[model samples]
Structures are given as C-alpha cells and as structure tokens.
Target: MNNHKKEKGDVMVEKGKLVKISYDGYVNEKLFDTTNEELAKKEGIYNPRMIYGPVTIVVGEEMLLPGLDEALLEMEVGEERELVLPPEKAFGKRDPSKVRVVPIKEFQKFNIRPVVGMPVNIDGNVGKVVSINSGRVLVDFNHEFAGKEVKYRLKLEEVVEEPEEIVKELVKMYIPSINTDDLKIKMTKKTVTINLPEVCSFMNNIQTIKMAIANEVIKRLGVDKVSFVETFEKKKEDN
Candidate 1:
C-alpha cells in the first residue's frame, strides 16, 4: 500500500476526496522537487534528510500551488501528463516596486552586516539582499521563482473512497508524524474510532490534537460521533 498503484476505474478527481499524487517540478529544465527519491537523485537534487513518497491531499483544499490546484480538478486517477504554468498562474509576476535600496548605515546601527544574497527583514518586510554597494543595500522582496515558468510531471495515484481508508487519509493529513502502520482505524454505521498508539497519545497537548481530529472526522466524514482509544501496558509481576 506504500506504493501508489493505479486503481482500475473511471473516477475523476474532485473536491473533498482524499487524493494521492506523485509529481516532479522543474524550472528551466532543472529539477526542484519531486516525490520520488530515485527521480530526485537522477535529477541531481536529492537530499538525505528529505522524505520521498506520494503526497496525499484533498482536492480544492489549497494545499498545493494555485496552478496545481486548478489542474487537479480535471485529472483522473492513474493519468500521467506534463503541464507548463506561466508566471502569473504559478507564483505571480515579480513587482519592480518590491525592490528597494536601503542605507547600509541602517543595518550597521543594529550590529548587522549585510551581505549579497543574505535574507533580511527591513521595516517589517522580508526580502533577500541581492546586492551591496557603497553605503547602500539592495533588497528584492519578490518570491525567488516569481516571473519564472514551471513545469510539473504529474501522476494521479489513487482516489481514496472507502470510509476507513478515508479516515486514515484524514488522520495522515492531521497527524503526519504518526506512522501509518501504527494507526488503528475502524468505521461503523454511525461511529468511527481511532486508536492512537502510546507513542503518539502522550505527546504535548494531546487532548487538543484529539479534539481537532474528532472535529475534522465528524465534519468531513459525516460520522455522528468519533471516539479515541488510548492503551497503556501494565508492568509484569513475577509470581
């Protein structure tokens, strides 16, 4: 189940359904991000600390970029294609007014040394210092990829529909740190139960987390009541 195998059906992606997708994004033919490590390594941007796998998202949730979100509405499971997005559709065009020059003395007064390409926040605005000259620093507040075209190689892996599977997907979205294998989910006619392992239940502010999960489950899954089950092991007594 770890792999996003193509399901045999004619289901088209729509809003509020749990969706799993694998995609690779590129700018000017250079790989920037991908869900597969082998593809990432092949594209020369692999990071050891990165997690590589299909990402599950609810369509129309705005979890992805604007262009990708719009594209998801027309996608079918197991379909693969390449899409090119213009700057406006992607991250929006860069604004020249967002670029500003500041006096170097202003940074020096705060014990800060401004360097080209260093990130800086000035007057509550965040930007990268793209240049430094005599007595002045130039900052560009536009997004790094602004004005650039992007390409995405996308694959729709699965369209989750079953009640238990949908609950698991929602849990994965809410508590991603918990391993999927460790989650125990059950669905009945009017109720759904989630059993959180000891490792996940005892973390900081667990009651709040459980509350949020319950709310999401009831609101999204239409279950009348949601319950949480926590288990603790007793110490063995030698007879």
Candidate 2:
C-alpha cells in the first residue's frame, strides 16, 4: 500500500492520522529556564523519556500544542522531530496578580490543610500556597508551567485507519471509562453524538464535560460539530 495516498480516512500516517507516539519534553527559552541541564536531568526530562500513547489528531488539528502539531504535520512514519514552542504557543505567560491571599477558613470547608508552600485544589482550580498567616493564606493560581516555553521531541510510532480504531480513540478521549460498552456513539457527516448511560452518575454535569470533550474530538476527527446526550432520570418525568 502506498503510505502517502490522500484518501478519505485513508490513514495518512503523515498527518491527520490517528497514531500512537512516544515523546520526551523539555522546557527552556528566555521566558522560562531550568537551573541547568544537570538540574533538568535530575528531574527526568533532560534525557528522552518515553511517553507512548495513542492520539487521534488531524494534520491541522488544534488538538495538540499548536507548534508541536504543526511540526508533526511535516513528518513521515517513524519520523522524529524536536519542536520548540513559545510561551504564546505553549501554556501562556503567568499573571502575577493571579496570586492572592484568601481567608484560611475558605479552604477549611474542603477539609484541606492550609500549609505554607503546599499545593491544593480549590474548587477544581489548582494553586500552590505561598504563605500562611494567622487567618489568611496566600495562594498562586497560575499554572506551575505557565510563562514557560516548551520543547517536545516526538516520534510517531504507528498509524491506524480502522473505523473501530477511530471510534475507540473517540471514546477514550471523551469518556475515558474503560468499560465502554455502556456508552453509545452515533455519527453523521457533520455531527457526532455520544450517549451516556444512566449508571454514569458522575456525568450529572455532563453538558459541560461533553462540550469540552467534543471540542477536542471534533478537532482531531475533523468533524464540524458534535453533541452529547445523557440518559438520566428527569425530575419532571419522575413526578
């Protein structure tokens, strides 16, 4: 088989192909820098560490770090590339004002211990504690990786073209539940719909999660629209 043919879903391992990759990442540049290569090496990222996994991304999918995805589009099977992404292309710069002091009692409601220099998740927001005073605690909500340029050294390992494979990727990316038999998938030319079972109660706020998941899948699958439906009991119907 000619590996370069441009067929609809022909699996161009070149780009827009669903592939599994192993990659190592490093962060360096003017915006962000480690103490040194020695320190980075000690942190297990200076040397190429394996990060193998499957990803269903179209050649131009914005699903990946923009720069890394662009670089991968120019690669072939088993090809490797080292991509340097700027702050804007990476996680973006840190805002100093994101660090603020809040009453220690606010965190106590979540049963979290407010300690100086400890990391905590506040209402789904991850922040690190900078200081703890008598009643107030300083927390920085900026991402730890913010204000950093990142380098991704990646190699495409395999490309798969089967519809089932595509479906599996879609399921994994969205539901992430290993027991996929409970989830239902339906697709049309312009839109794909995912149906969740009643047993998945954690999906009560599925609308928000669904939109986020659909956004990622649509970008990779090259679909224009997607929607999700949950199979939960309706309060009105119950009455």
Candidate 3:
C-alpha cells in the first residue's frame, strides 16, 4: 500500500494496520471506561494505575472486543462513530452454571476468609464471592459486565503505516518504561532484529515480553522471524 502519499484522514483502516483511537465505553449510558482522563475523572471512575490516553490497537487481531474489531475495519482515519453492541459481541451472555457454591473448607484451606463481593481465584479461574452462608460460599464466575449491552464512542485518530513505526509502537506497547527512540531496530525482507536495552536483562518477565513482541511482529508484519538481542556491557573501574 502506498500509504505515504495518502493524506491524513483519507486512508482507510484495514486488518493488520496499527490504529490509535480514543474511546468512551458506556453501559446504560453510564461511563464504564474511557481513554480520556478528564472524562474518567468526571465520571468518578478514575483509576490511578491505568495509563489514560488514546490507545493503539492492531486492527482485527482480537485485541479489542469482537464488535469493536469489526467496526474498526470499516472506519477511515479521523472518522468518529458511536456503536451499541449486544451481549454476544460485548462480553457474552451470563451463564447460570457459572454461579456455584463452594464449601467453606475450600476457603479455609487457602487461609482466606470469604466475604460478600470479594474477588477470588479458584483453581486458576477468577470469580467473585456473592454470599457466604452456613459453611458454603457462593461464587459467580461470569465476567462482571456479562449479559450487559455496551456502547462505545470511538474516534479513529491515526493509522500507522511504516514497518519501522509499527515495530516501535509494538515495543512501546510491550515495554512502556523503555523509550522507543532509544531502541535499535533492524528490519530485513523477512526478519526483524531488536537490540534491547541493558535494563531489560534484569527483568524477570523479559523473556515473556520478548516472546510476545516477537509473536506480534511476525504475525502482523508478515515477517518470517523476529529476534531480540540483549547485551550487557561491563563498566570500567574508575581511574
């Protein structure tokens, strides 16, 4: 695609393109989530841990909900739309079977004191405790917003085109602490090589991050392989 010559707002977004967008998600007209910091604050749902701003997503990669992914492909850069998604496309209908009663002994075994509305993980599945009565704990395993219709107001900010920019965006998404400008990325016809910073060598999850980065780049960029090179230099003694 000769994306360079196309002016901003004229390019059509397609599958595998990197897209940056700002969105406000609501359920029953009540804001549930938003990329705008001010709106989140105004709605009294501000989360300090969340990095609020326009988010970048790889289109059609299931990075977003199924409904949103479908909507993204039809949008042009700078276009804005509001969409209402049914339960199936949003979070799926809630299942009655997902609500189960567990014996109080199970919680006791884990040294947990079950309380109403407490979130707990059981056998690797996350659930919320609904009620605790007479030696039994009721847990609901459904997603918090399951069975609810959702609304999203989305603005397509930009569609990223260049392979180098794509790699940088991926790296930034994975390693938020690292500066993309400091990264050394080399791309060939069928491969991408990334020289990681020295700090990455000390992170316990660096291997997993490298694997995720490699997987995305190869899958979305159609590269045969992605390699990460980590180098640690020795410091000389003070003269």
Candidate 4:
C-alpha cells in the first residue's frame, strides 16, 4: 500500500472511467471523513445520514476534490497512496473579504437570534457567526476548513466498464435506497431503459432523481436516452 508500483498488464485509470474508491481524509491529524463505517464511528464522525462505503467517481469529472481527482489518474486498480494537499487543493485559502458585518436586525427580521458560532444563511450564502455585539453580527463566509492542509489515504477499489453496471451504479448513487437487483436495465442501441423497483414509484423527488440520473448517464456514458418504467400491480381480493 505504501509503494505505488503498477506492473505490466494492469488496468490504469483514465479519464471518464467510472472507478470506485475508499479514502480517509484528515485535517491536522484528525480524521475528518472516511469511507469505512467502523473507522468513522471510532473517530466520532459517524453520521446516520451518510452511506459509508466505497463511492464511484467519474475520472476527471471534478466530482471529487481537485487534489484527489488528479491523483486518481496516476493510479491503477488496487493501488493505495497517501498524499498531503495544500490549502489551495483542499478547500482554498481563507479570504478576509468573506468576513462581513450585518445589522442584528437582519436576523430579527427572519425570527432568528444570532449567536456566536452559529451558522446562518443570508442572501443564499452560508456563513458562520463569529461574533455578535453592538447590534452587529460578524459572519465569516469562508469554508470551515479553509486555509488548512489535508491528508488522504486513498485506495482505488474497482474500475467499472460494463454499461449495465455503470448505469446501475449511477442509479444507486442518486437513489441509494433502491436495490440494484430490483432494477431491470435494458440497453438498446443508444438508449438505456430502466424498470424501477416498486418502492421507487412512491419515493419523493423521484422525477427529479430520474432526470438527474438520465443527465449523468448521458453525460458520462454517451447514452442517447434513459427511460424509466414504473409499474403498479392490482391486488385481487377474495371473499
């Protein structure tokens, strides 16, 4: 895992390839994010809303942080590497201009009481309140990790090439609750037809999700169209 040596006949990662990766990201030697569930729990960063596992990313697509995304191009399947990224590659340097003072009445207008260390959204920009005094609230709009170096231990798990599996992975990425086995994927020429599971029919934001899935498939896989078929069955009641 320490030495990244690719032998002959190894499948090298390339742009536009769908690859799965597991990584642990650290800032100031403290684990900030990880793909391992147990490690996340151990580090007290486990979130119930997060799905802990290897995530698929399209190479060179900027889906990942810039540093990590560039590193993947030089790796092969099963290769592991540890790299430290500068602030620019991580979250970018902190900007003093991003810090602004707003009148406390702005918060009161929205029924909000501004408090130190509280996050707030103003004019669609997310910022954290650093201080509140004299009827003025200081908000810093820089990212929480701005101006910090980050370290990552990365492992490229698999490079997915099959069209069917690629579509399935994309679907799962958007609708994590949908079982891939329950999805019937049919590819005809340039179109990919997915018969969604029964559970998906009632899921919220399904239409939006379908549109997103279709856009990804077309953008990444060059598919002409994606069709989703949802079917409902009638139950027969007997006396």
lDDT of 2 by residue, 1-239 (tens): 11243446532346556765545567653223232355456664453442224444555657766776776665566766766778777777899998988888898887778878799877788899999888889999998878887886667666656544565565565555435566678877777777767655565565666667677667656788776676776656655
| Winning model by TM-score | 4
Which stretches of candidate 2 lie above 4 Å from their native place?
1-17, 28-52, 57-62, 175-239
**Ten consecutive residues with minimal summed lDDT in candidate 1?**
1-10
lDDT of 3 by residue, 11-127 (tens): 467787788988999998999999999999999999998888877888898889899988888777777888899999998999999999999999999898999999999999899
lDDT of all the models against the reference?
0.83, 0.65, 0.88, 0.90
Error of 1 at 121 (Å): 6.0
Question: Candidate 1, which segments miss by more than 4 Å at Cα?
Answer: 1-10, 100-112, 120-126, 133-136, 201-209, 232-239
Which portions of model 3 miss their true places by more than 4 Å? 1-11, 188-191, 220-225, 231-239
Q: Lowest summed lDDT over 10 consecutive residues: which window, candidate 2?
A: 28-37
Candidate 4: tens digits of C-alpha lDDT, residues 1-239: 74547678866689988889999999999999999999999999999988889988888988888899998988988889998999998889999999999999999998999889999999999999999889989999999999999999999999988889999999988887667898899897799999997779888999999999999889877878889999777878998
Rank the models by lDDT, top first.
4, 3, 1, 2
TM-score of each: 0.79, 0.56, 0.83, 0.90
Better of 1 and 3 by lDDT: 3
Q: Write the per-residue lDDT of candidate 1 for residues 147-218, one digit (tens) a residue.
A: 999998888889888778777777777776667788888888889989888777668887887888788788
TM-score, structure 1 vs. true: 0.79
Pull out the clashing pairs in model 4.
none
